[model samples]
Structure formats: structure tokens, C-alpha cells
Target: MENIFFPKVVQAVAGENRTVYAYMNDGSIRLVDMKPMIKQGGIFSQLEKDTFFEERLTVLNDTVAWDLTGEHDPTQCIDIDPFTVAECPAVADPLEIVG
Candidate 1:
């Protein structure tokens, strides 16, 4: 079976338990739970600190990412898999608009 994928992520917003990623195609949004990954404690350990985690949410081309170097270095970055994010459940009703 082949996997269907969404368009690349253009923006990401961090929240208490999850991060919302907005895709380029049709403005679709996906909510990814990052708590589990952050608890694993490896490269994600930096996110254990609330301020750092909330402040680090960034977009690295097509994925939700973090800039660990405190500089604009892509090499010292970490990001979630685009496919995984696309497959996760939506943060809210897909048809509803808050604005």
C-alpha cells in the first residue's frame, strides 16, 4: 500500500501538550502530540524545560522544528517527520474556522 501525504508545513505553533502545523496545501492543519517524544529524553531533553520548548517551535522548510544552537544553523536542528505529522489527528474540526 502506498502512503498519501499532505503538503509541506509552512507554520507551526506550540502549545501545552501539542503543536499545530499548518500545511501549504489548502491550509490544512495537523496537531501532533509532542509530550511523549519529549519524555523519551534524548535530543528532546532540551524540551523538558517549558520555556525552551514553547519558545523553540519553528518551521524548517516542510517540518516543525527546533533550533538548538541558539543560532540560525540548520545542522543543529531537530524536526518531526512530515509524514507522521500529516497522519496525526487534526487539532480541531477540519471544517471549522475559529476566525
Candidate 2:
């Protein structure tokens, strides 16, 4: 029997150019660019604001999420699927290079 691993985001850091660095439980970091989604408007419109996008960035439901209400309620947050995030190419820790 083979064990299936499900990716879960343990931490998330908002970056310039509307990118998010997702730190996964599998010890991998995935970069998610939210610009495409934000361009689609609707619920994603709120994230268009740079301050709001960075401030609300968080990890919820084990994935990258935005806490719109600042209440930390999973139901009220906008979250990306962990599997979708995991599909992104893995990258080295950006913080390491910056520091």
C-alpha cells in the first residue's frame, strides 16, 4: 500500500508583485501569483488593494487564505485549494536570499 501525502500550507508570506510564498508541511515552498485571480474581479476584487492583500494574507483551512473579516473564521476567509497551490513549482526560501 502506498501512502498518499496531502499538501498543507503551514505558513504564508505575501510578496511583491502580488505573490505569496506558501510554506507547506512537506518542507517545500510554493509561490502563488494572485494577480490573475484578482484581475477576474468579483470576490477577488477586494484583494486588489495592496494593503488589504498583504494584511489579510493568512493560512486557513490548511491553505493560503485571506481573512476578510479579521476574525480568523475559516468560513469567512477566501482560501485557495492546497492541491492547487501544491501544483506550483517549488522554490527556495526567499527569506534566506533576502536576509
Candidate 3:
């Protein structure tokens, strides 16, 4: 897919069922359902624990990131590509974006 722009993530909230609400620089909010990605295993497997998954999410480098703490290598941080995540169907309302 051709992405003309990569929206900078401004905020995010992780919700149950592996859903993530991403607020982007374009002023559009997208709900990213990660259950399918997590099922693929590998680094995403670390998020199997609901508490860790929900509480550890952060916005970094204009994208949703996880494992930013010292326990994990900074370079190993798991994040979605900003270009790929941009232009997702927007949520109807900002308040409805919450997990």
C-alpha cells in the first residue's frame, strides 16, 4: 500500500481484547485491533499478559511502542510502522476512542 504521509502518534490507550486507540498528528483517532498481530507470536507474544499489554503502551517516535523500560533493549522496542498505521478509519468521536 502506498502511504503518502506518516501521521505522528500523539497519544494512545491500550484496551481489553488487544484493542488500541491511537491519537495521531492529523487530529484523527484510529482504533487498532492488535489481537491478530499478537497471535502471530514472536515479540508480540510478550503482550499476552493483559496487564502488561494495557499498561505498558506508550507513544514514541510518532508511533505506538512498548517495552520502553531498561529491561528491554531500546532498539528491541515493539512498535507499529507509522506509515502503515496512518489513515486508518477514524473513530466517530474522540471520547469514543477510549479503551
lDDT top scorer? 2
TM-score of each: 0.75, 0.93, 0.78
| Of candidates 2 and 1, the better by TM-score | 2
Residue 83 miss distance in model 2 (angstroms): 0.4
Cα error of candidate 2 at position 50, Å:
0.9
**Which 10 successive residues of model 2 have the least lDDT summed?**
90-99
In model 2, the runs with Cα more than 4 Å from the true position are 97-99
- lDDT score for candidate 1 against the true structure: 0.71
Task: Please report how far candidate 1 places residue 88 from its true position, in Å.
Answer: 1.1
lDDT of 1 by residue, 1-99 (tens): 998756677777775555444454446678777878878989988877777776777877578788787685767788887877777776553445778
lDDT of 1 at 4: 71
Displacement of residue 63 (Cα, Å) in model 3 is 0.2
**Predicted candidate 2 versus true structure: per-residue lDDT over 1-99, tens digit per residue:** 999999999999998899999999999999999999999999988888989899999999999999989999999998999999999889999889563
Task: Show the colliding residue pairs in model 3.
Answer: none
Candidate order by decreasing lDDT: 2, 3, 1
Instruction: Please identify which of the two predictions, 1 or 3, would achieve the higher TM-score against the true structure.
Output: 3
Model 2, global lDDT? 0.94
Better of 2 and 3 by TM-score: 2
Ranking by TM-score: 2, 3, 1
